[model samples]
Target: MRKTLEEKLVPPVPPAVRRAMLDAREALPPGGADVTARLFAAMKENRDAPTLPSSKSFRDAAASESTFRTLLRCLARYAPHICTSNAVTVSEEWYARRPKHVTMGKSTPVQPTIWPAAWRALAPALDAAPIKQSSKRRYRASIDRCAAMVRAGRASSDFGFVAAADLADAFLFNADATARVKPITAAGYLDGLIALGRFGGIDRVHLLPMQLVAEDLREQAAMMPKNKEARIGAFMERGGFGYAADRIAVCLRRAESLPVHSAAGRRALQTAMVCAVFMNKPARKGDMVSWRIGHDIVRQPNGEWSLAWQQGKTGKNTEAGVLWPEVCYILDLWILGGRPDRLVYHRYHELEGLFLLSQSECQAYRNLPSELTLSAIGVPSHDLRTAAADYMRHYDPEHAANVISAHLGHGSQKSGEAYRSECSAAAGQSEWQRSRMIWS
Candidate 1:
């Protein structure tokens, strides 16, 4: 076989080059490790070649555009190690250092007398539109993005207030402004345009761009099911969290056994305990952080601990009335000074939050740790909810869906059905294992 151009021209790299490559990778996101390794391997073999590819060529050749962006971010942090005077000119860091093209001005009610009637009418309609705060904020951001495009000479003047071909041209196809954005972000821009058109009373047919973008995204996303269980399992597997409940139990047990004598150790234990309860209750970040001590945590007449908190996502009042004894014990240790007396403080007493940091000085802060790492296994706090559903389905397949829906504060059975669908494959595996064990 003929040697390739790269193979013929480049000799094998040395230990120093490999060390530099590995050192550069520490700055990247977790997913970038493999890409960084491959890039470095090629660079190592060709010592005379540039340490990193030109930004455009690297981005164009990347299998995942997202990874390319991450590579750029990491390069910005460790550019000295990865690039030299002859390396990529159009790196993300260079662009970042340039003056920001986007700007926001104070918004005022559109003066009906000074503006076109269609554009002026939009102001009142937008104010009257019934939408959530988050949606409203997104709409405002979309308007701002459109305005920036116009100021940057990428779009026509009539972009946001009144819809036209120019708006879609700038938002969807204007390469100068949105060339780097992901399809999902483009879809969001389309949504913002549709909302603007709706409020402006533009013809429905004129909103074809937004519809087309949505259809395109839907077609792409259809390649994989949006089942929460599959997503949770994939997230865990990527982080070395085993696919079974027993594996997760072992990881949690190891986490819980960490010493609590020091402040940092106590904090780790606190995060672990919170994570265990989060999995047990299948709670969302909002639910975990919103808990108030006296209101959410109550001792029942039977002496068992219970939790009652409103789930903001579904707007439903929820209760995890039957807590496991282990969960209760962990909560007791956390609340009653898990750390040494000399290191403990009492300022947390004044805070209204249930999930405070374990450090005495930082206990007044109100956010729960959103992620936990147990040895090599990492679990996101939000995914714990899905893991809980999966666990229940494996152990109690018949009533798992309905039971988990109620436990997780879902408003409808359809929500539960999504979880059940995701858990089906895992549940089947569990069933087969049980049957095999019984026969053996």
Candidate 2:
């Protein structure tokens, strides 16, 4: 009974509840969001619902916590680490509603999801598509801007009025005049002139706006299976978001040309860069473009998302409901994202054009914290992870380790200890594309 309910819960029982369930768990609609509160109610009543919990679902979530903490998070609409006191009572009630697990006398396989039937029939010969390289700086700036705009009312424009004279009298805007003052230039003037509203505080203008070629949407679009559970790699294998061999090659060049000695050295340097970006934010492996949800890219209204994923490590169903929005969104955008189908697909490699790239003695970030120590210099990826934190704490100082940890997805503030050292963080996965200078 317990396992069956847990397995079937993927599609959700009642879709109304299901949609809300997903909203409560992952994607949240802007405003009118009582999900955190409702989610808490649900967790308090979870044992009464007749289902077994899954550990994988929550354990692997970015910044996942103990089962008790997870339930409290859903109840409180915030993470335990951030919460103050109100959450304690909600969590206590959650454990009180426990269900008996007699049905799990033996371990049965979790049932197959609807996506398998929907996609398994794909022909082995589907036409392969080309992928292009993405602009990490551009991608990062765009995401940061888009999220900020949504919080503000300016991103959406309304045009219901129809007045010919008023419209004709309006100023004519064109490239000639627009070129006189770049958006960046205008933003600088504005910051000096007016008060930017507070959503996340720094009222920086969203640069990745549509229309301008230079201020192009920091786009990285990838289309993959709609199923939430599917890994983004499945979709990226085919390529989307203009991510092509050319672009990847460029990024690789950038990574390789960095002053680092080897791949690990490059990775160290990349880590340092991420440390710089995520100074005040919580940082996680999945938070950077390197760990996007879809391994490749996805086209989102905001911009392009290259990685889509479901963490395989998190289990315990109760913990799955707590998602740290901006943090998860950042993680899902490129780093840890990719369609599972693409990962499993036979043609993914050929279409991805990643085959031309060689596998490192390191499995990219996957083999990070590799069992193979520095034959003599000897420091693990964990050390690198730590070094990143320590450096941020000492050298960067201004940014919050919590913010860095949130972005990095460390289990604890102890993870923030990485800020206390002299560490070099470098980008690893596609370094060759990062620092390269293209002749064309």
Candidate 3:
């Protein structure tokens, strides 16, 4: 009744490759694709069964049973007929729209404007970043609606794109209002405040701190149990202030010279740094944090590495595990600060977000565009992992999937596919965009 993938077919491993894998594991790293390849090869030649991640890691990667089903699809692609699946009808499928509208249509060849898309990118910063209690369901509804619209031909590639050749208006978003273009009234600000108190985190729509909600948030935070710091961090991040947590993580990483003498900075720094450590482990931030374990990281007889807490923002479910070097560096930094057991990345997340906010505060004093300042890096904390994926792909096309999957702690490979975020990195982005306009 139960057919194990490992029991089926195996890939042949040469002695030379085995030696290479052992050498690399001892010297270079453990999760290197070469090691994985060698292990697969050995399984074929010697009929040696494969290793698995600790159950804790696997559970972390698979937040729910449905998520595990998705993992089966990824496995089938990577290793054909390796895993089994229970097929469900297409009528059972559903969709969910994300944070905002995504327009995918035929390209009419709009030229890139002289204005940097950087400011538009930065528009998400400030008091505007907010997600509501009702928002997620609304978004999910939107996706379902979008799917139906597509199927009915109400919206399709034929619907076409905006005709503007330039994006002088893209930066023109309603910051003081809902993303729906409504003016941000007192009620809107209040709605944002309630959401923040309910969901605080970097990804939260309510990114900025509110003078009115300050006391309320503090009271709410104080009542949360000490062990539930993960939830607290999520609340902050979900409110669009997760970056603040990241800054705190950065501070913890380099806590040696941080000016503790500055009262506000020290307090904010300490709070953010501590949160990053707790929040770094997998969990969604809202009223509370919930942790899950997956099969991949389970300590089964076949599992290889020991299970440890993950540092992915989307929790273990969507994001893959951190790279060994990156994880080690984070741990070493934590040890240096005499806070080895403390949650490191959550602190970094807090520190990073606070630092950005402080920088924006300084910018506000000068009346400069803080949005432009934030987008200078062109990406966020998580993009570094995707950047790493792109870097790996740049180095090798074939082995990119395995290394990226292990690195990001994902149960599957879709995130790696979504790594094509950068315009230049996308397959067809250059087809229409020209570096030179032939001015001569």
Error of 2 at 197 (Å): 58
Per-model TM values vs. the true structure = 0.50, 0.19, 0.25
Pull out the clashing pairs in model 1. Answer: none
Candidate 2 global CA lDDT score: 0.30
Alpha carbon lDDT at 230, candidate 2: 33
Ranking by TM-score: 1, 3, 2
Stretches off by above 4 angstroms in model 2 are 1-380, 395-399, 413-440
What ranking of all candidate models by lDDT puts the best one first?
Answer: 1, 3, 2
Query: lDDT (CA) for every model shown?
Result: 0.54, 0.30, 0.33
RMSD after CA superposition, every candidate: 18.4, 25.7, 26.4
Write candidate 1's Cα lDDT for 1-440 as tens digits: 86432342232433444345455544446655444444555454444345434334453434564665565554444443443212222333344555554457544454322333444457667767887655666776666665566556665544332333455456556666635444455556657656867877877666665567556654655564555456566765664223333444554455345422223444555665575566557677655665666567654434356788877667788888868876665555555433322221232243334444432222332234465423323555666666666667767775677777887789777767677775666667767988999999
Runs of candidate 3 with Cα error greater than 4 angstroms are: 1-254, 258-378, 409-440
lDDT tens string, model 3, 1-440? 64332322224533443444344434433223333343344335543323222223333334344454454333333333221111111101212212234347543464432212322233244225464424543333333322332344333311112201011011123232332211222223333323333342323333233323334434554565543234334433444234544554555444443322223333334333224322333222221112121222211222221224433333443432442333334333432232322334433343332222121112122111122212322222343344445556555544556655665566555554554334225434443344334432
Superior candidate under TM-score, 1 versus 3: 1
